[model samples]
Every structure is written in C-alpha cells, then in structure tokens.
Target chain A: MRHVATNNRDPEPKPLSEPVFLILTSLADQPRHGYALLRDIQDISNGRVALSTGTLYGALRRLLEEDWIERFKQKDTSRDKQAYQLTSEGRRQLRLEVERMRQLARVAGARMKESEG
Target chain B: MRQTSMTILWLYPAEYREAFGPEIVDTIAQRAGEACLQGLAAYAAFAAGEFAGLLLGALREWTTKWTARDGYMSPPDFAVEAADVPDLQRRIQQLIRGMEFAIANHDFPKARLYSDRERIMRARLDRLLSAGNLYQSR
Candidate 1:
C-alpha cells in the first residue's frame, strides 16, 4: 500500500457521529422541529437511536454555531415550534460523510470477497 | 411530574436553556405519557440521559468558547434581541426566588446552582447592554 500527501493546509473532514449524521439525513428532505426531528431520526435509524431532548438540542446548538444548520420560525407555528433546516454547508458536509461511509463499505465488501475467494 | 421535569431543565447552562428551553419542555411534556407507558426503567434511563446530556452540553459550550471555534466569533443577533430582554429579566427574578428559597432551606448547593445561573443570565444581559452601547454610538 502507498500513501500520498498533498500541500493542503487544512485537515480532511472527519465522519460525523451517528446521531448527527442521522439528523442531517432527516433534514435533508425538509425542515423539522425538535420533536419531529426526534421522531424522524428514530424512524431513519430503525429505532436503534433515540435522542434525548438534551442531546438533540445540544447537537442543534452546535450545528447552528457551525453554520451547518439554521433555525427559522414558520408563520403557522408558535415559537416553540421553531424548525431547523440544513444549510448549504450542512448539505455539503452530509454528502461528504455519506461518500466516506460508502467508500469504507466498498473496501470492506471487497475484503470480504477476497476472503471468500 | 411535569413541573419537576421542567426544573430538571434548569440543570442546563442558562444560554442553552434560553435558546431551546420552551421547545424542550414541550417535547418532554408531549412525550411524558408515552414514557410512562414504556415502563419505569425506560423512563429512568431517559431522565438519567437527559441530565448527563445537559452536563455534556455545558462542557461543550465552555470548551468551544475557550477554543474560539468558528461561527462563534459574533454572538447571535438574538443574543441581544429586544424581545428577549423582558424574558431574561423575568428569568433573573425567578432565579433570585430560587436562590432565596434554597437559602431559606439552608441548601448551599442548590443556592449555588441558582447563583451560577443568575450570574450567567446577568453576563448575557451585560453583553447585550454593551452591544447596545456600540449600536447607539454607531
């Protein structure tokens, strides 16, 4: 195996945690409020991961701070029903993370094939 | 039980609470019956996780500020939104009540908790006031 290095000053983006990845995935389609996100994320992950209120809000705060997501109020809803949507930056990051996972899966699949052969 | 859960929300840092408090409380209240339906162990675990998550969130907020993370340079506009000032003032009043109650009961630790949240709320107000000064000068 060989490795190559480039003269980029910035580090490569890392994979997101399961909850964060799932949150972004859920929001990829449409904006959601806190409880809606909780429900959607559970559905998306086959009920394997259920985010507590504190954890979900904490991730939301970080995402807002990172400019990866944005909060907005809908006219039809009250303040407590404020919804969040993914930013362009968030979408880009989500794509990158999905690609990273895909690549890893490919490698693992190939390794399995080689062992079977 | 609902009021007690709302108080558990106070365990979070004031900044976090201010930003998402109502929604979180609403979410918990909406789901409380279901959690009860799920059985005691499940509810206990969820409560435990919520407290732990609050601690983790506070640590994260402190660390991110200490490290001066990106997108944290400018405080959010709502940080000083005029609409929030009254709410913040009301919260400060409540915190004082809490502190007084704690002290009356000789609960030093609980008093400290109220004191700490009050300090945080005041600091946020101070920052908003200072920002107002700059806005006025401009």
Candidate 2:
C-alpha cells in the first residue's frame, strides 16, 4: 500500500478545502462517483458553483489521505478506474460541517427576519 | 500502432472521458489487455494527476477561510493561475513514451517523469491563492 506521511495526528480534523467539505458532505447521505458528486453539488448550489475536475479529484484525494474517505472501487479488477466512499471519519466530518452551516444559517435568519419586520 | 493506445487514453477523464463521455469507461475493461506503451502512460498519468489534485485540493480548502470572506467586498477575485489545470493528455503521452523507451532500451527515462513532476507541482503550489476580493451570497 502506498503511504503518504500524515500532516498531523489529530483524530478529528476539519475539511481542508471547500471542495472536500462539500464532497464529503455529499456522500454523507450516500456513495457517489466522480461525475455524480459534481452534479449533486451543482444541483444543491443551484449552479452558483460547479466543481471542476481538478477541484473534485483534489478533495477526493485529501479525504482519502486523512482516512476520512475510503476508495470504494475494486482494484482487483486490475484497472485504474476506481471509485470512493465516505469512511466513518468522513461521516463525522460531514456532520460537523452540516451543523456548522446550520448554526450560521440560524443566526443569519433570525437577524434578517427581525430586521425586515 | 500507438493509435490503439488512444483507446486507453480515452479512458481518462479529460482526453477521452470528457470528449467521449462515460462510454470509454465501460469499454476500458475490454480494451485494456496488453495495451501499448502510450496507453499505459495515459493510465499512470491520469492516476498520478488525480492523486496529486486530491491531496492538494483538500489541503487548500482546509487552510482557506471560507467563512471569513463573507460580507467583505463586492466579489471574490480568486487567482486564476492557481486554478489552471495542467494538460493531462500531453503528460500522459509523454509518460508512455518514457516507459516504452526505458523498457525497450533498458535505461531510466527522466524526461517523462519530469513532465509528471511538473503537473504534480501545481497541486502543491506553496503560495497562498486568494479568491480575489469577496462576494456575498447565501
């Protein structure tokens, strides 16, 4: 197995990039392939942002490196074509990101609604 | 002929995948048998690039201040030079040539590997790339 040195020993780390934060979160619900994940992010963002190939693969690698996500593709098939899925760590990270977003939304909503009224 | 390698190269996202769509991946299993030198290069290059991109992308996001940018300016002016994606086809083709030459002549070929290195370098680019100014949105 190829190995990359770990940057730090933290057990639970935050998503390093927006792409990864989004990618891992996307799979929090279910596993997906390269294109499918990109489409889902686009759908949710309502086209405000789209993940390019570089951004998509970039986050996928980081998530894998941190052991946050595991490669789901079958390497035994002897082909480089591979797929990936969220690991337990990845799921936890996704949950944190979701809650963080939720909290921010809640605060923003109260302020905006109160001001309008 | 090396043209057959094109089938293998086509399996990767940019050259064949983006151009031909998902059809290439379906056929990759059938055509990958003893593929020529160029095809092997394409496969390795794609994987290497994918690995590099995944690692660096996460690192950048982990470091960037996504929330801090909110309500700061008119629009986020992110740096484009950092956003550029290297040409995958050229690197893959070169890698194939390097390996083929090394195998046929029995020596290390540095050029192809160098090309691969350059592609990988951009992923880990050290400078901070700001997302231009700032833009507000929900």
Candidate 3:
C-alpha cells in the first residue's frame, strides 16, 4: 500500500492506520454511530474493505482513546450502542492526512504524465 | 381491532440498540407488525428471527471484542502468550486453570458459560497484553 505523509520540517507524521484513516474520511460528512459508520465505509469503498466486527470496534476504541474522535451520544433505549463524532483534533488530523495523500497523488500524476510524453 | 400478530421485527435483536437508538427499534417493530397484518406467516417468522439473530450476533461480536485480549484471535502460541505469562510454563498452567473454569461448568449453554469463561479469558488476556505484540515479534 502506498503511504503518504506531510514532509514538514518538524517531523514526518505517521501514516494513519488504513481502517482508521478510512473511518475518519467517512465521518467527515456527519456524525455516525458504529454500525452506520461501518455501512458507510462499506458503501464508499464499494466493498473493498469489509471491516470485521472486531476490526471496526477495535479501531473505534483506539480512535476514541486517542481523542481523534469521541462518543457523541449513547443510545438509551438501545442496548449498549453508542454513536461517535469526530473531535476537532480528529478533523484536523484527517485534513492533514488528506492533504498528504493529495500531494502524493499530484506528484505521481505529474510523473506518470511525463512518462507518456 | 383484529388480534394482529405481526412479526414486525423483520429487524430482530437490535444490536443492543445502543448505536441506532429508537429508529432501528421502530423500524423492526413496524416491519414485524406489518408482516403480521399482511398474514405473511413464513416471512414474519424469518424476519423476526433474523432481527433477533443479527442483533444478538452483533452483540456477541461486541462482547467478544470487549472480553478479548486482542481484537482478533491469534493462536495461543508461545510468542503471543509467552511474553505476558513471564514463565511460559507457569502461565500456561494459569490458562489451563482458566480453561478449566471455562469448560468446568459443562452444564448447558456454552454461550452462557462465556461469562464464567470471561474471568479466565480476562486473566489470560491481561497476560497477553503484558506479553507484547506477538505478531510483530514474529
């Protein structure tokens, strides 16, 4: 898998774990609970990544712990299901990641185009 | 009103309903009830059962994750279990002890036994966590 990161003088940012990155991207639109988030990701990816229940929830746990995202609300009527929203920090991190990937793609595009010439 | 027996829960178990809130429940209830009104015998049963089955399955998955030392299971090999166990031999003994508890109550439902097994699982899980990233090691 191709990894992209910001080449800031301070330090190279770590690659977002693929599942974590994709999850964040999916959430950029609106708040999503766990299962809905899973569906959205599945739909967006066209089934390229079918997150197993374990992987989905595990990523959620880490993402919550890191303050990348947070529990937006708990469903009282529902049995123990909770919804998550991205934190401000999470949004910023996601933006940074997207930028990094864009940069990589731009460079790749130029190189590929040049090769044809 | 006719005694409408609707298996409207075409949606079934609810995924514990935590994430979805009332919306999913309403969906299930409405669907199940509608099925009853329509007199769809097999469809209602299948839908209701599925609703329960899927929700429970998801819940089971959720519980397993919370209870597990890792999100996914790897074999209880030396590398993963060894680090946390400290003395692998002794740790294995502890796991056997836990497994004994897990399998000890061979009464009825293995599903029911999970709570009991959880204790042992939790202990072993703790050891696994302390042990190190077994996958990376290999």
Candidate 4:
C-alpha cells in the first residue's frame, strides 16, 4: 500500500468536500457509475455543484482507499463502466455528518428567531 | 480535435490514462460532435480540471509512498513492487499503440479488445501499487 504520512490524526471525521459529500449521498441510495454519479450529484445540489470527471474520479479513489466506497464491475456493462457503492462505514459517516449539520442548522434557526422577535 | 483530446489525456498518469483515458476522450469527442464550438469549450474546461487531477494524483501517490511505514499508516494489503512499474508502463504503451493503430484502420472491435487489455493491466498495477509493494520486483 502506498503510505502517505501526515502528522495530524484527528479521531473526528472532518467535513467532506462538496463532491465527496454529494458522492456519498448519491451512493447512499444506490450504486452508480461515473456519469450517473455526476448527474445525480448535480441534481442533488440543485445544479449548484457540477463536478468534472477528473474531480469525481479523484474523490472516488480516496473514498475507495478509506473503504468508504467499493468498486464493482457490473455484469451487464462493459469493462470500462465501473460502478461504486457506499460501504457500511461510509453510511455511518454520512449519518454523522448529516447529524452535525442538522444541529448547527437548528442552533442557527433559533438565533434567527430570537433576532427577529 | 481527436489529437488535441489525446494530448490532454496524456497529462494523466500512465495507469490512469490506460483506465479512463479512452472514456474521457470519447466524452470530449461526443461533446465536440454534438455541441460544436460550445462543446469544444466545455472540453477545454474539462481537460483543465483533469490536468489538475493528474497533478493531484501524482501528489497522492507520492504521499502514500512517503507515509507508508511500519505502523505509520494502514496500507491496503496489496502493494505494487517498484520494479513492476516499468514493465507495466511498457505494456500500457504497447497496448495503447495497438489501440491507436486499430482505431486508425477503423477496426473498432480490435481497438476495443486492446482497450480492455489496457484496463486489466492498469488494474493490476493499481493493486500492486496499493499493496505498498514499493520494492524493486527483481
């Protein structure tokens, strides 16, 4: 395995990149190939975050390395048409991230209400 | 136009080029054919992003090599031996040449066959590289 050494080893999972988050979310529902993932991510983000093929693949590689996603060759598809699905660990991480954001939003909403009042 | 797309693809690592190079080029070609000038512009932007990705991929590969040590990082069980890279690279080049020749002759079926071989070779290299097999093969 290639070893990338970094000094920081935080136990907490950091917020994902836009592409990565969208990717995980897309896969949370079903496995998807490169172009499909791109389309789904754009739709999910309301067309706000369009990922180029390069960006999508780069995130896919990292996710695979982290065991957050698994790649498989679809039996019906050609060899070049690779697909990815979220692993159990990936689902847990996504849930955690969503919860964290939910809490932040809740606090922000309360603050807005107070200010308005 | 095809040549330009091919040149852009060359920015990627050899293995990466082997794996997805054709697909990316095909996408660009399709865009060029369908959208005309606008598609070419889109392809340019896409190629630029891919160029950045190539650099990023290199950085990641090198970093993995650096941080990989006993108990330092948990590398996947498979590793590519440093020695295997050259031969694999050669094979990739050969396959690519065959693909190009077949494509030039309009033998698309043969071209696809070569393309599949290239993909398989690239996956093997990725596996070896992932396993931290950094040592020379011999």
Q: Which candidate is the best by TM-score?
A: 1
Would you list the C-alpha lDDT of every candidate in the order shown? Answer: 0.70, 0.47, 0.53, 0.64
Kindly list the per-residue Cα lDDT of model 4 for residues A1-117, writing each as its tens digit. 011222223467788777888999999999987777877888999989877655676677667655577766545444555568886668988888899889989999999999999
Give the distance in Å from residue B106's predicted Cα in candidate 2 to where it truly belongs.
Answer: 44
After superposing all C-alphas onto the true structure, candidate 1 shows an RMSD in angstroms of 13.6
- Deviation in angstroms for A58 in model 2? 1.5
Better of 3 and 4 by DockQ: 4
Candidate 4: regions farther than 4 A off: A1-11, A76-80, B1-138
True contacts kept of each: 0.41, 0.15, 0.00, 0.15
Candidates ranked by DockQ: 1, 4, 2, 3
lDDT of candidate 4 over B1-138, digit per residue (tens): 557657756655555566556655554454345435567776567556655654565566446546643221222211222236677777777778877887789877667656655664566566556655654552
lDDT ranking, best first: 1, 4, 3, 2
lDDT for each residue of candidate 1 in A54-75, tens digit (9 for 90 to 100): 7788788877755577777745
For candidate 2, what is the DockQ-based docking class?
A: incorrect
Against the native chain B, each candidate's TM-score is 0.43, 0.23, 0.28, 0.37
Which rank order by TM-score, best down to worst? Answer: 1, 4, 3, 2
Worst window of 10 by summed lDDT in candidate 2 chain A = A1-10
DockQ of predictions, in order shown = 0.19, 0.06, 0.02, 0.09
Task: Please report, as a value between 0 and 1, the fraction of native contacts recovered by candidate 1.
Answer: 0.41
Better of 1 and 4 by DockQ: 1
Error of 3 at B7 (Å): 27
